[model samples]
Target: MRERWRQGRAARRAHHRRRGLRARLTRMFALVAILAVVLTTVLTVGATFRVLAQFGPGVGADTAWDAATWQQVASGAGRSIIRSAVQAAFLSALLAIFVAGLVTRQLTRPLARLADGAERLRAGDRSVQLPIPPRQDELRDLTATFNDLTLSLARQEAWRRGLVADIAHDLRTPLAVLRSEIEAMQDGVQPLDGAALARLHGEVLLLARLVTDLRTLSLAESGALSLEPRLLDAEEALRGLAEAYSVRAVEAGVTLTVHASSPLPLHVDSDRLRQALGNILDNALRYAAPGPVKLSAWADGEGTHLSIRDDGPGFRPDDLARAFERFYRADASRTRDPQGRASSGLGLAIARALVEAQGGRLAARNHPEGGAEFTLTFPVPSGEPPSPQTRMVTRAPSSSR
Candidate 1:
């Protein structure tokens, strides 16, 4: 019984294992052979009479085809005609074989690639780069579509990993605080009061801020961040940001200086412009020595630039390279705020997003003499973005904001 079942299964499998060409080619060759005989007979008869006419015209188109004469004509004509037809048919078959091989190979290349890709996909290999032919025809379009699917899948995988990490990190601190609060209350070690309530409030706020920043950054990167652009008073924007950061700087024992060329207006969103300055100011104040925080703005022909420099231990020479990556903190400056307080490391990343959404540019670098400088540049009020200068260097790929 088992042997019979196994045989049945094997037969079923064999049913789908297609014999692609042998059966079809055999039938086609049989049909060609029969057609060739009829064609040869017809042509031979016509040729014999015509050839016999050159021997004599007295048959008057009614020459009696006697057995001997007919047999002789048939034998001679059939041999010659059949031989030539055989040669011609062989040559045609050889040519057809070569042409069929070429066309079949060309047409099946894409199908072959599709098969290979399926095998790799079964093996879970996502980085395979199977390129499609670059013709403007249907094959090219199909290849392009496959490439897009591969890229989209890769991106989604990466996004999944990143989101998981971000979420875990985001949850860790807040959860730890909440746990500690509950433990303290349970043990009667600390009473729930104004101080405890405030701490809890702060932690919740921090958690909320992280969620908000993540959403904002995602929106900006996905091209969904909306902008409200207008003519910006660059001087006013700088002054407001400087004032906001001055108190924080003074508390940290750093002098704050805000300088602006009077009323330099720009084609920008006022709120986003202020956010850009605020981010620079916060970074400067956070890293500056207990000495000075300098914020300055000026217009240069077709564009305007704002600079914030701090005397504190500014960014290291290489730290400028990845300053705007979300959650990244410089190795030397990941501690507390100026007053020895904690901070979410998303400030610069959020600031960069806002700047980019408005089609502007921002970057950070080490000051020549000493310290760190963040420069945010925008096209001046001439209604178009300014062309970059010959010697000016770019550190980060800036946004259009």
Candidate 2:
């Protein structure tokens, strides 16, 4: 394998040597310079001879020139023409050299800076920012793209650090609970009763759930999450989910309703889609007010659209921006559910990832009237993408409600 890799690299280098950009440009400039010199010499010699031919005969005819006089005139004229051609060739060569030098300098400097920036980035420098080339050309575009890439990588690195911290924090609580309980029982400070055993079991469950969610997210992000896609009726899916969550909504004292403007078809991984929808529905039911939470479906030119909106206190402005971030909770200090159960905060993040893996988009926004709305747009195989046109609508809060 190593030998094959080395051979492939050598082949590529040889190919580049024959047709590299810099080499091609250098050859072009050399050809142009040589042609300029040749043309200048030819034109200068021809013009000089033409002038002598027209003037030399007048001198011979008017002066009764002898063979010696003719020889002197011809020799001087030839020397003059040769001198002029030499001077023209010399000037052309100088100009060509100067232009070639400028071209090489302009091309090589930017490329060197780009290479240096890449090296710095590889060495873990997130602050590397390449200056955009001034010329409005492909090189300028390349520089701009490099800057964008560096910025994106830096942001991803920061997010990764935050994820690690969040995961540690999430794991610490359950592990601490289990350790404390076991230690207490061992010290005879606490009895190993049903209550104590149940508490330990709950902590284990929480840890299991957190681990599973982390695994799912990792798989989705890495494109390792497999999907079994089928043609699904979008309207039916929405109705079914709304029905499934209705009981939870009732338990939470929130009204749940499903509305389908029209039937729409979609090709998707049903189980994955349901998992994503369940998370969204769970969030809506958890945070919504006693008013109605609507799940609606419709078809547009862009494909099928499903939205879940609640009349609850809308997301805090800051939370709205990063609600989909993994392990991100709005109330950071309040880490438990309303029932005081531990929460992983991976629901929306997982939902977004699963939806995206199946060629869909999941987004959240506050309803204009009052509340948060989560919209899932799934593109049909035969339909246009939702990016060009969106058909989700925001309704005003009813005064009567």
Candidate 3:
């Protein structure tokens, strides 16, 4: 155990040390080479001056430093100054090679990390994080940019896994429901009354919801999350969500409330805004234990705002941090809901993506008063179309949700 601990400490210390030494060595070695060149220049100038002085200030073939004695001066300078310069140049070049090698080693650290990260990704590791240096040097920026890419890749990998699991789990519930209903009919245990038919219909509706959400996810991932911004009534948007989910809320025994401080006006993608609002509302209704589902919107100093809060079982610290991760179910069990109903869990992820794609921000938190609140903040139109439209989205057929 002690040997293992020592090895760990050594590795950590070496890693931290290597993190900066490349840049440091590069600057130091370049400075030393320049200084050496400067020194050689000064010495060569001095040798020229010494020869001029010996020639008695008159540069002529017959002077003391002239033809016959010029050989001595020339030989002396070449034997000493030129040779010394040659040696010095060779030494500095050698030093430069050493420094360059060390610096290159440091620089390649990121490349090595990139390779390792790629290999781990290839090996299906979604938890890899690349080490990047602090400043914004070109190589450091490249490393940071690569790490950012890796981070995004890791997130998408996680999303892909969640999507598969959600699909399997989602299919199980409906298939089981349909299977049970079919078996009952075959066994004549329960007559295929409208009530029994209604259960299958509900299952089909749930399946439809799952399919719709999955298709949306696929479209979003394929870079087709397009939007058309327009000036719309914020209250109307909130009302749309309320109206869509009103029946579901009623069936779930959850009250839906729409509170807006009089038509909060804003510029936004109407359909995307509606979808975001619906997702939040749906999530609140689905997860909240018998309680009120509150939808509220208003204008703050920054922009228009909308939130859906529920007096449900709120998230814990871990869950809240990753609540927007696609299909990340805090309640992973199948038997936790009030009516044993479960979710596909992509609601919040899609909601936040849509919100952000509109030059807005969305966040989820546990209300101090005992529920979870998701807030979407949008920037008010600044009297001009944003440059090239919102950047986080790609173009697709426009729709009003």
Best by lDDT: 2
The C-alpha RMSD of each candidate to the native structure, in angstroms, is: 14.4, 9.4, 11.1
Model 1: per-residue Cα lDDT over 1-401, one tens digit each: 66999999777446423322343345555666666666666666656665666546535577766778767766776676666667656655665576567656755797689778768866877676677764344455566677777777777778678767867886797879988997998899989899898888878877787787678778877779777788766666766665566557557666666667666667777876776677666666566657776777777763688887877676655667878866767854554565655556777887777777777788888788888888887767665453332222111112111
Measured against the true structure, the TM-scores of the candidates, in listed sequence, are: 0.64, 0.79, 0.65
lDDT of 2 by residue, 121-143 (tens): 99999989988877644466678
Shift of residue 158 alpha carbon in model 3, Å: 4.1
* C-alpha RMSD of candidate 3: 11.1
Q: Which of candidates 2 and 3 is the stronger one according to lDDT?
A: 2
- Residue runs of model 3 more than 4 Å from their true location after superposition: 1-159, 183-197, 221-223, 239-257, 284-293, 311-343, 383-401
Clashes of 2: 0
Arrange candidates by lDDT, highest first: which order? 2, 3, 1
lDDT of 3 at 370: 84
Q: How would the candidate models be sorted by TM-score, starting from the highest?
A: 2, 3, 1
| Residue-level lDDT for 202 in candidate 1 | 77
What C-alpha lDDT does candidate 1 achieve relative to the native structure? 0.68
- Candidate 2: give its CA RMSD in angstroms: 9.4
Q: List the residue pairs that clash in candidate 1.
A: 288-312, 289-312, 358-401, 359-400, 359-401, 360-400, 360-401
